[model samples]
Target: MMRAFKSLFWIEFKLSVRAMNLVLFGLFSPAVVAVIIGVIYGAKPAFDGAGYSFMAQSFGALSGIGICATGLMGLPLALADYRHRKILKRFEVTPVSPGMLLFVQVAVNFVYALAAMAMVYGICRMFGGGWEGGSFLYFGLSFLLVTVSIYSLGMLVASVAGNIKTANLLCTVLYFPMLIFSGATLPYEVMPPALQHVADIMPLTQGVKLMKNAALGLPIENAAVPVAVMVILAVICVVVSIRFFRWE
Candidate 1:
C-alpha cells in the first residue's frame, strides 16, 4: 500500500510540473496581484490602527489572501477537471486508491502555495516590508494553519463540483468577498457594520487574523479565535469532501 501510494504521488507531481499552465495559474496570478498592491501602496501605512505598522501588516494580510485564492481556486478547479475527464477513474483501475490520489493532489498544491508565499515574502522584503516577529516557529504554525484550512476547503469544493468550469466559477465567487472584507486587501475595521458581519464568517478573515497575530508575536489568544474558525472549516470540509468526492 505504501509503495503504491508513493508511486501515485510521484506520478501526480510529475504531471503537475509538466502542466505549465496550471503552474502559471496557481502560482503566478497571486504573485502578480501582490506585486501590484505592493507597488501602489507599499510605502504607505497599512492603516491608522494603533501599534500596527502598515506595510508589515499589509504584506502579512496579502500573503494570507494570496494563499486562499491560489490554493482554493486553482487547486480545486484542476482536480475537478481531472476527475470530470475520468483521469481519476483511470487511476482507480490501478493499484492506486482514491485516497492516495486526493492526497497527492493536496501535496502538490501545498507546494505551489509555499512557492507563491515565498514570492510574496521576497517581493515585500524588496519593497521595505519588515518582519518584526523573531520566532520562526510562530510563523510556521500560523502558515500551517492557514494552508491546511485553505487546502481542505479546496478539497471540499472539488468533491462537489461536477466539472472544471463550475469549480472555477464557484471558487471565484467564494474568493472575492473574503478578499474585500477579510482584511486581505482591506481591513475589517474600516468596513461598514453589515459588511463586517459578513466578513466575520469568512475563513480567510480568520486566517488573516491569526497570521497577523503570529507575524507580530502577539499573545496566542490574539490568534485563537481565527485559528479555531479555520480548524473548524478544515474539519468540516475534509469530512464532506471525502464523503462526496467523485472520480468521474
Candidate 2:
C-alpha cells in the first residue's frame, strides 16, 4: 500500500504540474509575491514600531496564500475532476484503492503548498529576512494549523460538489476573496475599519494574524480564539466530508 500510494502520488503530482494551475498559483505565485516584497522592502521593519522585517511580518500571510491556492482550489478541483472522469470508480476494481487516490491528491497539494512556502522563505532569506530567534518552530506550527483548517474546507467542497464547475465556483468564491482581503496579497492594515471588521471574521485572517505574530516573535494575545476557530472548523468539515464523500 505504501509503494502504491507513493507511485500514485508521483503520478498525480506530475499531472498537477502539467496542468499548471497548481504550479502557477500554488507554487510560483506565492514565491513571486515574496520576491517582490523582499526586493522592495529588503529587511525594512514592517512598520515604524514593529521591529520585524517586512518579510517576516508577511511570512504567515504569504504562506496562507499557497494554502488557499492548493487547498481551496487545487485539491477540490482535482477531486472533482477525478469524480467527473469516473477515475475514482475505476480505482475500486484495481490494486490501487480509491482511498489511495484521495490520499494522493491531498498529499500532492499539501506538498505544493509547503514547497511554495519554503521557496518564499528562502527568497526572504536572500533579501536579508528570516524568522526571529528560535521562532521558526512556532511559526511552522502556526502555519500547519492554518493549512489543516483550510484543507478541511477543500475536502468538504469535494464531498459536496458533483462536478468540476461546482468545485471551481466554490473555490473561486473562497480563494479570490481570501487572497485579496486576508492580507495574503494586500496589507491588512491598509483596509478601512469596516473592511477590517469584515476581514476579522475570515478564518484565514485570524490564521494569518496568528502566523504573523509567531513569525515576528511578537506577543500573541487572544490566540485561543483563533486556535479554537480552526480546530472547530477542521473537525466539522472533516466529519461532514467523510460522511458525504462521493467515492465514485
Report lDDT (Cα) of residue 80, candidate 2.
91
Write model 1 residue lDDT over 1-248, tens digit each, in one string: 88876776677778878976547856776677677877776756666554545556665686776577656776687788788888877866777655566677787777777887788777777666646663568777887888888888788888888888888888888777766788877766678998888887887777777777667667666566777778988889888888887777
Q: Which stretches of model 2 miss by more than 4 angstroms?
A: 94-100
lDDT against true structure, model 2: 0.85
What 10-residue stretch in candidate 1 is worst by lDDT? 46-55
Q: Write the per-residue lDDT of candidate 2 for residues 1-248, one digit (tens) a residue.
A: 89888888899989988899899989999999998998899989888987678887777788888998898989888889988998777776788644455567779999999999899888888887767653778788888888889888988888779888888899889888988998888989899989999998788998888888888778889999889999999989978887787866
What TM-score against the true fold does each predicted structure earn?
0.86, 0.92
TM-score quality measure for candidate 2: 0.92
Error of 2 at 27 (Å): 0.6
Best by lDDT: 2
